[model samples]
Target: MPSPAAPAHPAHLSPALTLLLATATGLAVASIYYVQPLLGLLSAQFGVGSASIGLLPTLTQLGYAAAILLLSPLGDRFDRRRIILWKAAALVAALAFAAWAPGFGALCVASVAIGLMATLAQDLVPAAATLAPEAERGKRVGQVMTGLLLGILLSRVAAGSLAAVAGWRAVYGSAAVAVAALMPLLWWRLPRFVPATQAGYGELLASMGRLWLQHAPLRRAAMAQGLLSVAFSAFWSTLALVLAGPDFGQGSAVAGAFGLAGAAGALAAPLAGGMADRRGPQAVIRVAALLVFLSFAVQAVAPASLWLLVAVAVVFDLGVQAALVSHQSVVYSLDPASRSRLNAVLVSGMFVGMASGAALGSSLLAAFGWRAVPVLGAVAALGAVVVSRHGRRA
Candidate 1:
């Protein structure tokens, strides 16, 4: 019998179909990130402090953690398509609530719900991993990952750009329709996976702990990605502030343009994934770390130049997406029996890092100034780089 990881490609599925689904995945997940770039505007409109506005993002992160904590393990228990459909349903509801949200408090409540619902992507991933053909899993997964990363990067602009034209509420309202439209396509196109009927939730939770304890690669990847996520989050969390400064004094639309800049790096995600397939994830991680260090170094020194910032954005994004794909490629390979739980653990760590980074960036901006925050960011990026090397060596 041929092994699951054998050399033959799974071209049974159409590339166009796969790419379409992957792009849909990215679009859906991007909903979670739409608010980050708009926090400043939200703060201004809601008459809240920056920290209070920050709650918009904080709640989303926690909600993601909570959803993954509870729902991801279900991937092992039932059809992943069910999980995806249900998640898409909830996302539409969440977007509706966010659209109609009356105040900061209401928006925060809606944000949490959105985050929780958006985590359906976490469940969706194991499904994507399973659908990927054996020999080209990394490349296939990478193609899916491109959409995920695009969702993350592009949604930033979506929020800002939308807010610039209509109101802040309209942006979220539009996401409602987008998510709703996706449900049918996914329902029709996604393949089915037979879930384990044997394991209970308690058993799954226990296994999550064991997965964390027993697998060095999972643990290392989680920590490294978590830290890098914090760095990435910090940059994004304060992007509006930087652009709104005297140097550029840009509006939300102009600020959103930076998302286009970050697209350069997002475009690199599939390349990194394919490379990981050929060279092994360790090499990919090592190379990604170098890119991160270079990007951060540039950010720290060239605070005044928009073109420099744009170039650095590409490098930073490249490092982040490359590192993430590398980690996912490795972790998804562990314990086919519990890939969902593994993803939950790995993604939850990123939530922790994201919340921490947003808070850290906000605090530093309030105290030491925006210029100083990227110094710490550069340090964080370097720290992640070193950690990645140690993980690779060990």
Candidate 2:
């Protein structure tokens, strides 16, 4: 199975294949996030404070960032389907270790491994782009991204609800089972993708730096996504703390329920893709940035209202998802041969920003409470807008 007989480059993805990629991307990405809403429960179980537990999400994202840099580029040098299958197997093992970790240190290490293996989704994204027609590329990427975002949002809900009934470890256990189940589906349906580059591992890694230096539009797209990621991470990373605090006194389930609100953002993705197709990605990105910036301000207006907070979640998610699709549309069109490496460079920045945001959001919530989160997130969203504006001029 290591070197299966396959075409140099398979035919374009059928709609069924496209749907498989979207579902696979979603499931794979979800592995890195199942612990989010479970953060409160894990904190109590591990005897850690809110601020300290932030390392869990931060380290997970850092691990993901590292995978994007180190592993995602390998897709361009090897068969992508093989990469996805082997990574999924590794992810199953990582999830099981996380479910059975005996201490905080063990759990933290497992979390990092889980995140690293979750880069299978990164592999699939570019593979999808490679299999689509240029005219349909944006739409296809948008659909895949919608699945990815839904996985992230729904993961919280599933983890929280499962933890409420079965315990924190149960969430990870279920995740392991889900990934194992997905393996057979992918093994049967996923098509092989030949390497576009004959570069060795060393050269593949080196080219990412060169790609960054060579492409200005790539730089703009990456910077904008990174800044927006800071805001997105800020909200999700801190929401559990805020809900469990004195005002709400709710458990993890409440945090998970809020994910439903954010799911509204998924609706904006197809629209953003179509808009990017019609008016250009930059135009769509501009609107996305403004929406995110405004969501933060609206959040500040009703800091203590739960229903209003839910509405803010919806608006913010919409903005973030829209910008993400637009950004991918821009960069994916830059170089088809470099799609995996390009996406690796782009999303790697976003994860770094996510890690930073998680750490920053935790500190702010621990110190000043909920009010500070929106303030900081707004600043980050506005930074994205500035980057987009600059990109327009350049």
Best by TM-score: 2
Tens-digit lDDT string for candidate 2 (314-335): 8888888889888988898889
Task: Quote the lDDT for 291 in model 1.
Answer: 80
Error of 1 at 69 (Å): 3.0
Candidate 2: residue 32 lDDT (0-100): 80
TM-score of each: 0.89, 0.93
What is each predicted model's overall lDDT from 0 to 1?
Answer: 0.78, 0.86
In terms of lDDT, the best-performing candidate is 2
Residue by residue across 1-394, what tens digits does model 1's lDDT show?
1122332223445676567667777767787788876876887888976656767777787788777777788777876666778888889999899999888788889988998888866765556667677787656766776678778878878888889989778988899988888777766666666676668889988988999999999988888888877777777777777777676677777667788888988786668877998999989987886787777777777748888778877888888878887998889898876676788888888788887787787777667766766776777778777888898678
